[model samples]
Target: MSNGVDRTILTKEHASGTVDRDTDLETVLRNAGRLSPRDALRYLTPLISVLEGLHTSGQSHGSLSLDLLRVTKGDDGAPRLRLLKGRPRKPTLQDASPKAALAGRMLLYSSPEQIQGAEACEFDDMYALGHMAYTLLVGEPYWIEEVDRLGFMALCNSIIGGAPEPPSVRAMRRKSIRLPHDFDAWFVLITTRKHPDHFRDITDAGIALTSVLSNPDIRELSRSVQFKFNPNILESPSSAVPAAPENLRFTAVFTIVASISLAIAIVMLLRWTNAQESPKRDPSLQSTDGAPATSNPSSR
Candidate 1:
């Protein structure tokens, strides 16, 4: 574990597959391996499992892009989704290079909150997963068109403030790109009808996306999505990634402060009520003289 007190060596295996056999998910998407909805679900199910496993191990794969997905055959000679690149490195402040902040890859795939200097958490991963889902379903990188034409700040502004068009719409616009029959329902469920201005977290949009992707058919997917929105769900329970201790401590302190403030407010409120209900001395008689004294109502 990195103590962040000294230099720690880190390594990432640079997971572009060997030249002869395997190809990245992006290349496949561009070519014949492009996924239909059913296939996309099939592929994403494993990816979610792998992501959960990473988080459970107290690591988040901060970088998840289309290129990180590798298409290779499993031991049984079936196609498999092998995720690669960026083993769980603790996000160090030193790595926050302004030059690399909005690099081309990030512009298209990074989460909205992440671009704003928020540390990458499972929520950020899930948000990026949403775009990845879009790329797979729509058979094209999500923001390629906009990024190609715009400047860096323009791209940043758009990703941060702009509303997203559903992937189904984009797929429909391309005559060559054919989406699956149930793609619309799936996209709508995942998006959760985002407000005109706001970002989505796992508690809201991410859980629905996760639930739907983990299931097989649209009917089952719909049910799973519905389950996440149910009041009884309480909070998102399957967050495989644990928050860092510092973050947890911060949350605890904030909660304590909030509770104390609430207690103080309640106490003050009770005191105010008691004062209102209790007997009040006549204004003039409040003086040493118990006899009433005349004074203008407006006088303090």
Candidate 2:
């Protein structure tokens, strides 16, 4: 039985003796660089078949990854894939903690729910398979940038919360491959969180993807299924962090104070102007007596 660890294997031609020349899927991909859609599908079909068989047998490859798979040549010289038997124990919150000893590399191919500590299921395997397909077609892992720049926790958070750009979009960025727009919808359908939204089976997914790549006239996904970032994962723990509300409150107070001051200043200015403009009583015109000082006296 194959364990998670690497081991020598014998090909049909070398059945009499074990051959240590088996290269892992990762190595093969690295050597091959970006593969065409048809070539990528050729490699993925066998893996998808294996997962389908496992699911049919009431089992799941809880830890499917590139390194766990080995590619060897068959008697016909065609590439063959062999999956290792053991699956890693799922990581938990404790395992994902900063002080935990688990390596982030182990979680590179993990599904969103898997990163969130959900129990292993066929969906997780399918999700990992989708990522593998993307890597083969796009020539790089989806989260490679996050892994390099942000460390394990950020990678985990990204997996849980971040939505991956479509393979076609990433291919555009790479400038090496051109994929159909329909393939983008197919990727979303396969990797969507809602299990019921996925294809009927892994075989169906493979067939759909093959059709999508080979035929331009193929219809797009019947319904749009966009994977938005999980707010729960992306939300900051410090809910009390200052935001627009505080700034808005300060602005409102300042505006009210300014308006009042402006109003008061206007009132005072109007009163001062009225008093200055008012015609003062002339001393010459004022009579010494309280009685009226008549202009008639001047006339006499």
Candidate 3:
């Protein structure tokens, strides 16, 4: 347990040991790596076992704090994480139960202090797993941090207690720091509550993320097009890439023909209007010397 003075809360009937309190953050990170996808899942295998035990016993580790945890090397030199102290209180809340609220915060915010109440609901666990997967892929926190600071705070408020914001699409851009394709599955999985039928489960989310990230055909096509066109410097991509059909050569040709046809049609219409408005000379109008006669036909 941490050498710190934090009080321990009872997770089991008789709590055997305290929270891990080793001060080596690198060792703690190493232990975390054991559970993550980027590293061997063995080091972190015990965490799953702990979570499982919590699930079976209908109890949860309240007020989990990663900072307080300590890491010690086993005889085999593999990292082992021990709990140091219980969290002071629950981290965040949702409209759901304390457990559900905690789970939502853990998934949305990655805060250990708030996970005390996270129960093992299907959606909650799935979201948390996705959150873990995203952190693994991007080597950072959740995608929500990609937004501006205020927007990020507002998003945190919405996810935990405040009004929800629209799903962010800006994270998908190429210049974005953490690539959207990295968290494709997590995005789909988390949004599944909002769109159930599309992403059925975690497996589907993983597959979709993989496909978007690894599509060779799409990559090849993008490369081919990038080399083919020197887009107009003044135009944005939305304007440079016209909404014509699939075959770019045919589409460009057809667009040119259509534009020329429209221009000719407009010119012809303008000419017709100008001709109709011109004042015509009246043949019957009487005049002095140069003008002919005017009203003799009716008299004859």
Best by lDDT: 2
How well does each candidate superpose onto the true structure, as a TM-score?
0.52, 0.66, 0.38
Give per-residue lDDT, candidate 2, residue 226.
54
Q: How do all the candidates rank in terms of TM-score, highest first?
A: 2, 1, 3
After superposing candidate 2 on the true structure, give the runs of residues whose Cα lies further than 4 Å from its correct spot: 1-19, 75-78, 90-92, 97-102, 174-176, 216-219, 222-300
lDDT tens digits, residues 198-268, model 1?
22433344344444444434554333332112111111232123334687799999999999999999999
Whole-model Cα lDDT per candidate?
Answer: 0.56, 0.66, 0.40
Give the 10-residue window scoring lowest on summed lDDT in candidate 1.
Answer: 227-236
lDDT (10s digit) by residue, model 2, range 66-148: 76677776666755667775455756434756643345666667887887878888877877877787788777876665565
Candidate 1 C-alpha error for residue 5, in Å = 46
Cα displacement (angstroms), candidate 1, residue 120, comes to 0.8
Model 2 residue 194 distance off true place after TM-score fit, in angstroms: 1.6
Please write out the lDDT profile of model 3 over residues 41-135, one tens digit for every residue.
Answer: 22223333454556456554443323334456555565565544333443443333434433343334333223334533434434544444444
lDDT of 2 at 18: 47
Looking at model 3, which ten-residue stretch has the lowest summed lDDT? Answer: 225-234
Off by over 4 Å in 1: 1-20, 87-102, 174-300
lDDT of 1: 0.56
